[model samples]
Target: MGGYGSGRLHDGRVLCMGGPWVSAIAKDDRFVAGWVTHATRWGIVRGRGNSGGMGGLRMSYRRLYVPGATYFFTVVTYDRRPLFSDPVNVQLLREAFRRVKQHHPFTVEAIVVLPDHIHTLWTLPEGDADFSTRWRLIKTYVSRRCAKTYQPPGSASRQQKSERTVWQRRFWEHLIRNQRDFDNHVAYIHNNPVKHGLATTPEAWPHSSIHRSP
Candidate 1:
């Protein structure tokens, strides 16, 4: 029986808690089931009927990965907490992105950070579809630095795993299939702050990358 931080995958590979929960990936990069745990702001949920072991249930969702492509992402804070309402936290988020980008290069096409969520577009380098790992590192960096001040009290299960409540366990990601899709996502990212009534216009949002656009 593996606890929150570690487990064994279907193929008997060791699973490490890089992020909030562990995603068991097979040799072919497919997510398989074994000792799977999913986390929310409230607590961690293990597979049905499995109390303390590393085997049970299956993951129903599949993530799409395309090398050298554009992606749109919507990432939210745990329990929709307004952690980004403070400008300092927004700067911290930027620092995390910068730190991750230095080692794993990616282009930030567009981005907007709101009080509780963020919308952004990114372009991965050729032959690289490992955005998942990049995101894991970024989240880890932010969580390590901001957990004390921004993170709420987590559940016992989460505390056992040493999970931070900074960001949601999962984020919404979309692979951009065409130029039209990229344009639409960029527009959506810029307008999101206004839609949420955080700003009168997109340009009024100081934390967004819109001001840096040509």
Candidate 2:
């Protein structure tokens, strides 16, 4: 907010806009949510969702303190609402997630890559922190990668200030609190394929948490 741009981030609306969106950021507890934003038509966001501390954290704060527990994260593609990816693309997305993990040294405890979306349970490493920055970096990188792979059905159209298209700009997340939540999220990600009838059993889906979980 203060460091990167100018004054307070303009209040914007969480518009279910037609373009791509972003997922929630889990940076340090103090400012991660500020980064996860929705698209607004008139540059008007939903209120004080715009608060930045101006200066970037000193080098010391870069190694911020984060809990070692598991956290839930969800991100979606640019309105590609249905799970639509070749095995290769899915793998690429997973690789991108892997890159994100390196930054924080976290374990993707669970993950499900739906045709249009993804859910992950990430556990931050000891001492390292800030899930928000991790999500932001992942979204940016994966979206860029997804753009390269996404080929439109027909001739391409020219757009101003933009060339690539792949993912939405925003996402949602939840910090896993207890055993029930963990089990429920695991079930939710695994059952995603079943809910879509993509497979008779969750294990049948190649792109899901079921495969990652032991």
Best by lDDT: 1
TM-scores for every predicted model: 0.70, 0.59
Error of 2 at 105 (Å): 1.3
TM-score of 2: 0.59
- After superposition, candidate 1 runs with Cα above 4 Å error: 1-61
Q: Write the per-residue lDDT of candidate 2 for residues 1-214, one digit (tens) a residue.
A: 0001011111211111011222222234234334333222233222222121212122221112234545566666765644255776676776767776555556665677778877766665544446767777766665566664563554266224454456555455554434444557767777877886778998898876555313
Give the candidate number with the greatest TM-score.
1
> What's the distance in Å from true for residue 185, model 1?
0.6
Compared with the true structure, all predictions reach lDDT values of 0.65, 0.51
Model 1 lDDT tens row, 1-214? 0011232323334434322333444343233222122222223221122111101223344454555656677777988889888888888888988888889987777788889988887777656667888889988888888888765764657867998888888776665544444556768888888888989999998888677624
195, model 2: CA deviation in Å?
0.9
